[model samples]
Target: MLRLPTFQLHEPASLKEACALFAEHGAAAKILAGGTDLLPNLKHEIYDVDHVISLAKLPGITGFEMQGHDLVIGALTPLAQVATNPNIQKHAPALAQAASLVAGPQHRQMGTLGGNVMLDTRCQWINQSYFWREALGFCLKKDGTVCHVVEGGKKCVAAASNDTAPALMTLGASLTFVSATGTREIPIEDLWVADGINNKSARPGEILTEIRLPLRDHTHHGAYGKLRERGSIDFPLLGCAVRIDLDDADCVRDAAVSLVALQARPLLIKGVDALLQGLKLGSTELDQAIEAVAQLAHKKCKPLDNIPGDKDYRRRMVPVYVRRTLRAALDGTGPVHHI
Candidate 1:
């Protein structure tokens, strides 16, 4: 039975208090949201923290509602609530689907939307018992100098395992963060960086507060697809999220495709809107457009041999999953494949 290290726990009654505590403790403190991810890492001794700041008591960070034309979701909102909320289902079905597909019912009940969004990068070698990793001399993501997946590699290549990030990115979401200094907002895409060791762009002492999504029009449609080793309790091997806006004639006016678990960060395939602009669904050009998007994804994605399944095989499936998700988004149907 793995045991967590000794630490001082702080229960902050409000966001301001939490920020103050974090500012005082600095890097020695770790934020505790759902504990689904952080607790396991603590037990495994993957990282050490002298202070554990709990956000359970923080106000204004536990629910969702519409603020004028945008949907404002508190960072501490539970994944289960996000998955089942009527507003999320109607306006951002891809986000709802992604949240629902995270881990299982119990995890969804405990995991927060912010926790899922801030999920750490994962690799097969590093996600093991302390003794197991100690025997292997550790990896760069933890306390080691070298990355086991890449010989003599200078940087970690752990894959991004978050589900909702891609979905939110597809919907043009922005994140609000607070710190001791002040608060700032940026597009969700800006929250990620490509490096695995230090993936998120959030600064020290910053707390992710909320997610804001733009209002969706009737012509907007979106879908999410994930490939995992199991139907539940498994991180995605490859995840795809797609959104398309269509005109009266069903021609695609704009499109976006975001993929996760393909790299160290969720990637928004570039030039998708340009490639898909003015293309009508069910037209001969549709297949070509899909293929073009798939090719672009293939170019951007460079999965390392750090996780389950053959790296080459996973790369090959990117196009397959992207194509399926795009079709589902356009047809207003769930993605055909989930494996």
Candidate 2:
């Protein structure tokens, strides 16, 4: 059995106390939420930490409710709760699907929304036992300079494997973060950075507190599609989330497409709305628009051979998955078929 290294545990009673502890410990401190991801990494000796700050005792960060015109989800809300929340299912079914599809039932019960959103970039070489990584001479994400995935690469190429980020991005979500110094809100897309070694843009001292989703109208629809190696307990090899708004005449007024597990950070496909706007859903022009969006997705998503599934096959699936997700969203069908 793998053993966790020695570390000081801090159970802060409040968010303020938690922020203070993080500020006091600085780089040596690591935040512990659901522990579904962090504990496994700790057992692998992926990174050493002198302090483990638990957020369990902090109140007001573990519920889901509607506030005015927005859906406010506390960051610490469990994935299971997020998946089953009636309001979320009604207003943002794509997020519900993403949350429900994460790992397995037990993991979904234990993993928090915050934990899922802040999931670390994953690579086949690095997400292994300590001995396993040591035998391969390590990678840039952990200790050594060289990246196993790329020849003489200057940066790590681990892929972002979060299931909910793309879904949340499609829903126009924003995050609220708090720290000892102050608090700020940023669009969900801004929460991710392009660097695999440090993929999240959250500062060292800030703690993500809540995720806010804008109000949706009757014409709005969304869908989430994920391709994984198995039916359950597997991270996504490629995931696509799409949201589109249709006018009275079935013409697309707005559309957004976001993809995960394709690169170091989840990407919002650029110019999707421009290509989709004013296009009727059932017209031949719609077929051309779909082709255009698929082509764009294929061009932008370049998967590396650092994770599960064939790199080339995963790349090829990008357009196929995007097309399927778009169809599901526009047709009011359920989640896209998983491959």
Candidate 3:
């Protein structure tokens, strides 16, 4: 039954208390929000801990307001709220679409937007427990020093499993982080680091308090596409999010494209901006842009053999998803609408 080891559970009423608890417990303390990922890992003894600090009692951050043209989403907001929020759908369609595709209804109800964004990802070899890992001689994400997904590699090979990161990037979002020391904000791209062990830039005592999304005008269009093994309840093998803003004359003003599950963090293709320059995102133009985006992403990402999909298949589908998602965005077909 993979029973979790006994541990002290601390429920803090405020962010201050949560930070203090984390500091007190140090590396021995684990933070708990939606137990969607942490609980299973605990049950398998992936990492031993003495304390579980709960962030449930803390008041959930909500309310979408305009700071000039920017929209702010509270970090503690639930996935269900983000998925169904009409304000989000109207302002940032790509983000709303990604929120809707995260897991199923039950998970959406219990899981939170902050938890989803902060969640640590997995590789096929790294997700197994101590016994399975011991048999495999361990991986860099766990106890081993070498990357099992890539033989003789020194770095961990866990994939970026977040559903929201790519979408938020397309919307030009930034994250607000609060810690025992102070508070600061940085672009979403900056929050993720290159190393899997520290993929998140948040310190041990830090908390992600908010996500700031730049509001899209009526001229802007965006979409999100997820490729998974099942109809639902499976994490993405490959995913893409794209946003484009056009002038009144239908000329491209700006473009953002991000791909997920390909590496330790979401891969942003800045080349899309150059490819989309001064042209409308029609089928022909989008095709060329997708090719450019795919090539850039392929160069940046080195997908491991650990996950389910073939490397060649994932590589081929990068352009496919890029083309399809961009087309859907241009057509104003929201993720929910396409489903």
Q: Indicate the residue-level lDDT of 307 in model 3.
A: 72
The list of candidate 3 runs beyond 4 A from truth reads 281-287, 294-301, 334-339
Please report, in order, the local distance difference test score of every candidate based on alpha carbons.
Answer: 0.89, 0.91, 0.80
Per-residue lDDT of candidate 3, residues 1-339 (tens digit): 678889999999988888888878888988887788788889767777999988888875654666887888888788888988998888888888888888888887777777888878768887777788898787777677888777688887678888888998888789988777788888888888877765888778777878998777788888899988776777788878888899898888888889888878888886788877688656576567667766776666566675779988887777777767877888887552224
- Model 1 clash count equals 0
Q: Where is model 1 poorest over a 10-residue stretch in terms of lDDT?
A: 330-339
> By lDDT, highest first, what's the ranking?
2, 1, 3
Give model 2's TM-score versus the native structure: 0.98
Candidate order (TM-score): 2, 1, 3
Q: What tens digits encode model 1's per-residue C-alpha lDDT throughout 271-329?
A: 99999989988998987998899888888887779888889999999888888898888
Question: Pairing residues by index, what is the TM-score of model 3?
Answer: 0.93
**Residue 107 lDDT, candidate 2, scale 0-100:** 96
Which one wins on TM-score? Answer: 2
Candidate 2 lDDT tens digits, 1-339: 899999999999999999999999988988999999999999988877899999989999989877899989999999999999988877888898889889999999999999999999999988999999898798899978898889999888899999999999989999999999999999998888889888998998889999999978788888889899888899999989999989999899999999999779999999999999999979999889988999999998899998989999999999999998998887878577564
- Return whichever of 2 and 3 wins on TM-score: 2
Q: What is the lDDT of residue 187 in candidate 1?
A: 94
- The regions of model 2 sitting more than 4 angstroms off are none
Q: Which residue pairs clash within candidate 2?
A: none
**Clash totals for all models, in order?**
0, 0, 0
